[model samples]
Target: MKLGIIKLSVLITSVLLLAFQPAGKKPIKVYLIGDSTMSIKDTRKYPETGWGMPFAHFFDEKVAVDNRAKNGRSTKTFLSENLWQPVLNQLKEGDWVFIQFGHNDESPEKVGRYTTPTEYKTNLTRYITESRSKGANPVLLTPVARRSFDASGKIQETHGEYSDLARAVAREQQVPLIDMDKKTQQLLQEFGPEHSKLLFLQLKPGEHPNYPNGVDDNTHFSELGARLVAQLVLAEVKAQNLPLAERIYKPDPK
Candidate 1:
């Protein structure tokens, strides 16, 4: 009888300890949906990194950054191609979807991808509505700026109507807005015309094997530029006091 009593006591203790153990935390996911500026690059595009790549590492392990941003997808194509559906299906409560699509949408010259301002607003609204329906928060971001400067060394607004449309959607939907276009343009202005080249894919011929003829791309970002841009986004996240900011990886004090 004493042996049986001791066995029962052990079992009870075990159960109590197990019950008191801290529950494992469910990871929060932050989805990034945008264009080449935020998409992951191929190994061949080595020094040319995307802001999403660096943004992924800025968060703690409890926050998973899933970058769904592609090379040339506008909001219209992303929806029609069924890219947004998968993300919609996977979304759970408290997950975040960062939606940014203006570059390709603004390119009226590209008939295949040109999304009119009305269509842009409608698409953005659909994203916000659907994401909310699934209990996920959707953040709208304007397109990142291109490194364009007039001869007078002043930065230009390249996004035009699309940026304004994104702002309008954010306001209508009450979603968080990150004006990446304006922010990046400010960053470029600070660097000036000549110095800003360091932030882009400005390669000299024969300098890198990937681009034998060299590249003078002002749209795509170099690794340094991508990180800086990611930092800007992170700063905005903190400034906006988004719940995900709590998951950002902060170093311990020395």
Candidate 2:
């Protein structure tokens, strides 16, 4: 009878200990760092959405997508403005950092934002190294494509060497890479040029309250475009079989 009581107590103690064990489902944060293509737009901007905005919804409650990308910023400006420090400070193990750039970085015309190819590579390396130092995973994505088409309506490669440089860094650092530039180019090709305009901020005059006269911006994405890109990223995440993929929100088929 005493042995039975002792065994019962031991079992209770074991259950108690197991109950107090640290939870394996601790919430994770995915930090998005880059340019306007991925930044959250102001409410006034309405339909002009950023892919990161829609991306925030793809994960379950156990994940938080913190998009730190800003308009007209590049690797150079993002670091110089001290944007990366706050993210670095908050990083924890099992977190992720998705880094995408180019756009303004490739344009020498953009005085403050242009990051030379060498500097771009160095900056990407720094992001990878620093992110890894925190035990966080770092993903490098070549910038998404700009809307451009040739006479035959074939989408052209707009990122050029910057995308290649990003690829080189990913290869050398052994980081996960989502080739968004190539992926987005294919997406555009699938949509074709005229239909592709549906993905951009192509509003007619007086169509939207904000852009009263109308806007024909190609770099930023419309609502449909943003959601599509976000879905594409999620698909790539699943394809890569990332740990975070398990947190992706899966709806009931029923």
Q: Give the RMSD in angstroms, all C-alphas superposed, for model 2.
A: 3.3
- lDDT digits (tens) for residues 1-254 of candidate 2: 99999999999999999999997777999999999989999999988999999999988888999999999989999999999999999999999999999998899999988999999999999999999999999999999998999999999999899999999999999999999999999999999989999999999999999999999988899999999999989999999998888999998899
Q: Global lDDT of each model?
A: 0.93, 0.94
- Model 1 spans > 4 angstroms off: 1-24
The most accurate candidate by lDDT is: 2
Task: Give a tens-digit lDDT track for model 1, residues 221-242.
Answer: 9999999999999999999999
| RMSD vs true structure, all candidates | 2.0, 3.3
Candidate 2 lDDT (Cα, whole model)?
0.94
TM-score of each: 0.93, 0.92
